[model samples]
Structure formats: structure tokens, C-alpha cells
Target: MRTLRFLLQKEFRQILRSRSLLISIILGPVIQLTLLPLAANFEVKKIAVAVVDHDHSTYSNKLIAKIYASKYFSGGTYHSSYEAANKMIEQNKADIILEIPQGFERNLVREGHEEVYVAVNAINGTKAGVGSGYLGAIVADFNQDVRLQWNQPGHFSEAPTIDVVNANWYNPFMSYFLFMVPGLIVSLLTGIGAFSASLNIVKEKEIGTIEQINVTPIKKHHFILGKLIPYWVLSMFVFTIGMLVSRFAYGIVPVGNIGLLYGFLSAYLITLLGAGLLISTYSDTQQQAVSLAFFFVLVFNMISGVFTSIDSMPDWGKALSYLSPMSHFAAVMRMVVLKGSTFHDIQPHFIAIIILGIVFNTWAVLNYRKTT
Candidate 1:
């Protein structure tokens, strides 16, 4: 216990004495917690619309009003002709173009049907889909309202109609910030653990302190442990801060067992520390360690689905993600944050991490040697 405390205190002191460590530890989490959530959302809004009304009647004007009133669409520009609206769409000024044919109200009143043209930009497929749905919904509602006014018996018919009681489960209303903050936290922790931890040790070796340590009574394992304990503690601290920020900024509450989370996180940090140690062991200079760590971290962050969905990735890319700790961590984090999955629900992932931790730690230790 005494030795452990001494080691912890010494490591803390060493970390504090280094300005770079202090900045990365503090600013890294802050930037991730504050900025990344805003940048990683998929929600569509404020789509520009254009209107072509040849009818010049109250019905055409009302239809245009309906489109503009939709929360999904911004106010539309009035075009005298479809050709004019088409130019606006082609110029990227309009996301959707609507055209009501001439004599639309006359056709609706006499024949009970009128045609409306809707042209959408297919370049952004998802947004175009959403915009099409919005336009369709508005027109459908208007049709129902017209039916009630014109065809209803005293406008109070109680017929069996299919009413959709749409309810969103789990992350209801889909707060994008809540979805992204946790993933950013994982990315930041991996960067700090993989980069900063190795940098300090490699610097020591470059400056000849490692040579003196080799002649001391300390074993290779003990020396590595002593070096890693500080960053392990720092990583845990950063995670706690991230959780607090999640609750306050994103209103994200963890539904999983907190004990299980911390337990797995403990093992996860060991794996990350092993990676840092492995880099330090192989690197003769701090520059090499930093460059190699940066490359690996970038690859891991991209493949891990930090900003994108892993489900969208190809089978081979998804399968290769097993090699990345961030991939596993991001999955578990999102599972806990959104789905409220139990440890039992994540057992396979947990077991995989355990095996990976053992393998990385063993490799790091084997690469580590003491020379007198």
C-alpha cells in the first residue's frame, strides 16, 4: 500500500510538472465535450423551397402556405413559372421546387382532384428523402381537411381510420448532442492515452534516464507499471468529467450498471496503457513515438465509428474494427448511453476486451527489457 501510494504520488508529480500533459488532460476533454457534439449531427432542417403557382388562385396560394409552414422548410421563393424555379434549384438556391398547375382550384372544386408537381434535389439523398416526406405529409393533411369539410356528414363522422400513434423509444426526440458526446469522449481518451503517455517515457529514454534505470534494482514490469499508473488514473478522471458533462450539456443519463462500466473501464485503461508502453519500448526517440501513435490513433478513430455508424461500413471493414479498442469502447459507451444495455447484453464485447488487454499487456512486457 505504501509503495503504491508513493508511486502514485510520484507519477502525479511528474505529470503535473509537464505542461503538455496538463493541457492535453484538461483541454482535450473540454474541446470534445463542448465542440464535437455540435459537428456530428445528422438531423435535417431549414431546407430552402421554391414555389411555382400558375393557377394564381386561393387554392394554389394555400398550398404554398402549407409547404412553407412546415418546420422542415424555410420560406419559399415565389416563381412565376416552373422554368424559373428549376433554375433556382439548379443553382443550389432551392432544395425543393413546388408547382401548382393552372386552374387547380377549378379542377379541385369541379372534378375533386388537382395535380401538384414537386421536384427535389437528389444530390443529398437523406435530406431529399426527408423533404419529400414532409411535402407529402403536408399535402396529405390538406387533403384530409378538404374531405372533412366537403364530404363529411355534419363534419363529425366517426369511421375506423388508421391513426398512427408514433412514439420514439430510448433517445426520444433524438438529441444529437447526446448521441455524439460519448463517442467524442472515447476518441479523446484514446488520443491522450495512446499519445501523451508514450511521449513522456520516450523523452526520458532519449535523454539517457532509461539507461540509469536499467542499472537500478527495479524490474521491467514494475518500471512500466509505475510509468502507466499516472495516465490510468488520469484517463479515469477524464471519463468522470465526460459523464458529468454528458448529464449537464446533453441531458444524457446512463441506464446501465455503473459498477460494470467502471470495472470494464479499468481493464480498458490497462489495454490502452499497454499500447503506450509498447510504443515507448520500441521507440528510440520521442518524435518517433508521437508520430507512430498519431497514425495509429487516427486509424483507430476512423474505423471505430467515432463520427459515423459502424453498421454502414462494409463487412470486412467492420470485422477489422475488432483490432481497435476505440471501436469496442465506442460501442459499449453508446449501448450504455442510449440503449441502457446491461453487462450481460454486452458480454461478448467484454470478453473480447479482456482477451485484447491480456495480449497487449503481454506484448508490451515482452518488448520491454532491462539492460545493465
Candidate 2:
């Protein structure tokens, strides 16, 4: 117990004295939490469009105006020909081109339908798909409006319509910030645990401190616990700061019990610390530790179900993600934040983390030796 306490003191002093680690601990959460959510947005907007209008009719003008008025699209730049308009797409100035053929209004009025060619730059497939879909919806609405104007006091009566009552459950406005903040919190904690803890032992090894410790009467588990505890506590501090940032800056408040969330975090931090320390045990140099830590952290974050839905992934991907502590952490964080899920709801994740914590800590203890 005395030995562990002295070791804890040494670890804390070492962490505080390092300028680089201090800067990372201070700045990492704030910048990532504040900036990343705003930037890593999924909702596509401001689609640049080029227009070629040959008809110059009332309907054509109205359609052009309607497309421009939409929040999804940038105002269209009119070109003399389709060839001229397509050049905008080639130059990356336009994402989609809308060409109104000659006699577009005449054909629609006389034949009850007309086709207009739309050429979208498929270089950015998602932008193309979403931008084209927005244009199609706007055009469909315009057609409906034109038909209604010429209907002469409800001649055909209203067609059967099914309206979906949207129960948005958690995020009513679908703010991307709200969706991203929780996941970002998990990612921030993961980085702190992985990079910071992984560097600890390796740095000591490089500086010849590990040799002195190894020759001491210290137990391996005591050495591991002393290493893990300080960082775990510091990570909790960072997590608290992140949560505060989420509240004030992004307006995210945990719908579930905050204590329950903290309890889960406490256990989760142990698991992450164990993982980092395990990496530290295998690595001889700080460089090797960092590279290994980053590789694992990247893999864990990618499979963490933050950016992609686990259910939507392939069978193999979904199966493999279960091995990552981060996958469960991100899921549980979202559940607590959005769904107000209870302890019972998160029990399975809690158990998974506990199991991982045991495995990682045990491996780290076994791998680390008193002698080189």
C-alpha cells in the first residue's frame, strides 16, 4: 500500500511536469468538442447549380425562382447553352446543371408532361445524389403547384395522401451537433486514455526509471494500478470538462442519471487505462508506444459506431466491433444522452466493459517483467 501510494505520487508529478502532455490535456477536449461537432456535419447544403433556360416562359421563370429560393441550393447561374452550363460543372463551380428545353412550358401545357435534362457532376457521389434529390423534390412540388393553379376549383378532388407524423423521439430538430457531441466525448476520452497512459511506462523505460522500479520489491499489479489510477482520475476531469462544453456550447444535457453515466465512465476509464498500459508494456520506446497506441485508437474509433451505424454494417463488421471497448462506450453514451436509458438498459455494455477491463489489465500485468 505504501509503495503504491509513493508510485502514484511519482506518476502524478511526472504527468504534471511534462509540458507536452499538459498542453494536450488542457487543449485537446476543448478544441475537439467545440470545433469538431460543427465541422463534421452530415447534412448537405448549398448545392451549386447552373441553369439553361430556353423557353423563357412564366412556368420556367417560376421553376427557376423556386429552385433558387430553396435553402438546399445556391442561386443558379444562367448559361446560354447546355455546353456552356456544363463547363461550370467541369470547373467545379456547379454541382448540378438544369437545362430547360425549348417549348418546355408549351409541351407540358399541351401534352400534360415534359422532360427536362439534368446533368449532375458525379465526382462527389453523395453531394450529387443529395443535390439531385433536392432538385427533383423541388420540381415535383412546382408541378403540383402548376396543376393546382389550373384545376378550376377542385375538379378532380384531392388524391389520397398518407402523412407521416414525425416523432423525432430524442433530437427533434435533428441538430448534427447534438448527435455528434456524445460520440466526440467518447473519442476524446479514448485518446486521453490510449495516448497518455501508453506513453507513461515507455517514457520511464527510455529514461532508465523502469529499470530502478523493476529491481524494487514492487508487485506488478501495484505498478499497474499506480500507473492506471492517476490517469483514470485525470481523464475523468477531462470528461467533466467535455460534458460542460457539451452543455453550454452545444446545449446537450444528459437525459439519464448523471451519476449512472459517471459510474459507467469510471469503469470505462479503467478499461481504457488497461488497454494503454498493455500497449506500454509491449513497447520499448516512446515512439513505438505512440505508433501502436494510435493504430489501436484509430481502429477502435473507426469501429466505435459513432460515424456509422453498427446495425447497418456487414455481419463480420458488426461481430468484430464487439471486441472494441469504444464501440460499447459510444453506444452507451448516446443512449444515456439521447434516450435517457437506465442502468438496466446499459447493463450488457457495462458487463462487456468489465470483462475487457479484466482481460487488458491481466494481459498487461503478465506481459510486464521486473527484469528487462
Candidate 3:
């Protein structure tokens, strides 16, 4: 205990003395939590549209008005010819071109059917898909309105309708920030914990201080724990700051027990820090530790379901994602924060993280040589 305490003191002193590290530890989360949510939007809006109205009738103008009124669409450009609209799309000035053909209103009124050609710029697939969907919805709504206006007394007896009241359980408003902030917090915390722990021993090696501690009577476990403890405490502090920023900046408060979230985070950090120590044990210099840590962090972020859904990944990729500590942490965070998941709900992830911590820390211990 006494030896561990002294080592912890030394590590904290070193961390506090480094101005750059201190600033990063304090400012990095604030900046990311504040700025990332604004740009991480998944809901496509303000899609640029081009319209070619050949009919130019009252119905056609009403349809164009409906498209312009939608929040999803930007004010559309009116082109005289389909060729002109194609040119606009080629120039990247428009994402979609809606062409209302001649006799569109006449066919709808007289023949009960008409076709409107829609051409989309598929270069940005997500934008194209979302914009097209929004346009289709508007046209459907306009068709319904036309039917209601044309209905005579007792002619259309309120066509049977099945209203789908879509209930978004976790995020009712579908706020992108609600979905993204927690994942970002988990990812950033993982990187900070892993990078700091990985760099600790290697930094000592670079500065020629490892020889001094190695000659002491301290056990290997004590040295490892001492290295782990300070960063663990610092990471918890950073996590708290991140949570506060999430609350104030994005109105995100964990729907579950705060204690449960902290419990999962504790285990997740242990696994990440152990990986860092493993990197430190293998690396002889700070540069080598950084490169290795960056590599692991990048892989973890890519597979962790932060930017994309794990369910959408291939079977092999899903199986491989379980190997990443960030994957477990990201899942647990979303479950607890958004869904109000309990300990029982997150038991599998908790157990997985604990096993990872044990495996990684054991490997790091075996790799650490007092004499080397």
C-alpha cells in the first residue's frame, strides 16, 4: 500500500506538471461535446430541388407550393426544360429534379392516374434517398388533398385509413444529438484512458527513469496498479465533466441510474487502461507507444457502432467488434443513458468488459520485465 501510494503521488505530480497534457485533459471534452453534436446530424434537411413544370396549371403550381413548404426541402429552382434541369444537376446546383408532365392534372381528373418523373443526383446517396422520400411523401399528401377537394356529397365515404402513430421509444423527437453525444463521450474517454496509460511506462523509458524504479523492492503488480490508478481517477474526472457538458450543451441527462452508468464506465476504463499498459509494456519509447495506441484507438472507434450500426455490419465484423472494449462501452452507454437500462440489462457487456480487463492486464503484467 505504501509503495503504491508513493507511485501514485509521483504519477499525479508528473501529469499536473505537464501544461499541454493538463490543458488537453481539461479542454478536449468541452470542445468536442460542445461542437460535435452540431455537425453530427443524421436527419437530412434543406435538400436542394429543381422543378420543371411543363403543365404550369393550378394543380401543378399547388404541387410545387407543397414541395417548397416542406421543412426537408430548400426552395426549389424552376427550370423551363428537362434538359436545363439536367444541366443544373450536372453542375451540382440541384440534388433532385421533379418534372410535372403535360396533362398531369387532366390525366388525374379524367383517367384517375398520372406519372411525374423524378430524377435524382445519386452522387450523395444518403441525400438523394432522403430527398426523394420527402418528395414522394409530399406528392402523396397532395394527392390526398386533391381527392378530398374533388369529393361530392356522400361520394367518398372517408376511405379506410390506418394511421400509423410511430412512437420513437428512446428518442421521441429523434434528436441526433441524443443519439450521438453519449457515443462520443464513450469514445473520447476510451482514447484518453488508453493513450495516457499506454504512454506512461514508455515515457519513463524515454526519460531513463525506468531503471530507478526497477531496482526497488516493489512488486510488479504494485507498479502496474500505481500506473493504472492515477489515470483511472483522472479519466473519471474527465467523464464527469463530459456528462455535465452533455447536460448543459445538449440537454442530455441519463435516463437510468447514474450509479449504473458509472459502474459500467469503471469496468470499461479498466479494460482500456489495461490495453494501454500492454502497449506501454511492448513499446520502449513514447513515439512507439503513441503510434500503437493510435492504431488501436482507430480500430476501436471504427468498430464501436459510434458512426454506424453494428447490426448492419457483416457477421464476421460483428463477431470481431466484440473484441473491442469501445464496442461494449458504447452499447452500454446508449442502453443506460437513452433506454434507462438496468444492471441486469447491461450484465453481458459488464461481464465482457471485466473479462477483457483481466486478460489485458494479465498480459501486460507478464510482458513487463523488471530487469529489462
TM-score of each model, in listed order: 0.88, 0.96, 0.97
For candidate 2, the 10 contiguous residues with the lowest summed lDDT are 158-167
Question: Model 3: runs farther than 4 Å from truth?
Answer: 156-161
Candidate 1's C-alpha runs over 4 A off are: 1-9, 153-164
lDDT of 1 at 297: 92
lDDT of 1 by residue, 1-372 (tens): 455566668778888898977887887788777777786668888888898888989877777787777788895798988889999989999999888889998998888888789999999998899988889889988887776767767666556689898777876886777678778888888988888777867887989987877787766667777888888888899888888887887777887776777777888888888888888888989889988899889989989987777899899889878878778888888888778889888888888888888888788878878852
Give the TM-score ranking, best first: 3, 2, 1
After aligning candidate 3 to the native by TM-score, how far in Å is the CA of 198 from where it should be? 1.3
Q: Residues 1-372, candidate 2, lDDT per residue (tens digit)?
A: 998999999888888898888778978889888889878887889898999999999889999999989999985799989999988988999999999999999998888799888999999888999999999989988988877777656688766667657778789888888889999999988988899889988988999988988888899999999999999999999999999999999889899999989999998999999999999999999999999999999989888999888898898888779989999999999999998999999999999999999999999999999965
Ranked by TM-score, the better of candidates 2 and 3 is: 3
Model 3 clash pairs? Answer: none
Selected candidate, larger TM-score, 1 vs 2: 2
Write the residue-wise lDDT of candidate 3 on 1-372 in tens digits. 998889989988989999998778879888988998788778888888899999989899999988998888895799999999999999999999999999988998988778899999999999998899999989999988887877764986877778677899999998889999999998889888988899999988889888888888889999999999888889999999999999988899999999998888888888899999999999988899999999999989999999899999999889889989999999999999999999999999999999999999999988999984
Q: Model 3 lDDT vs. the true structure? A: 0.91
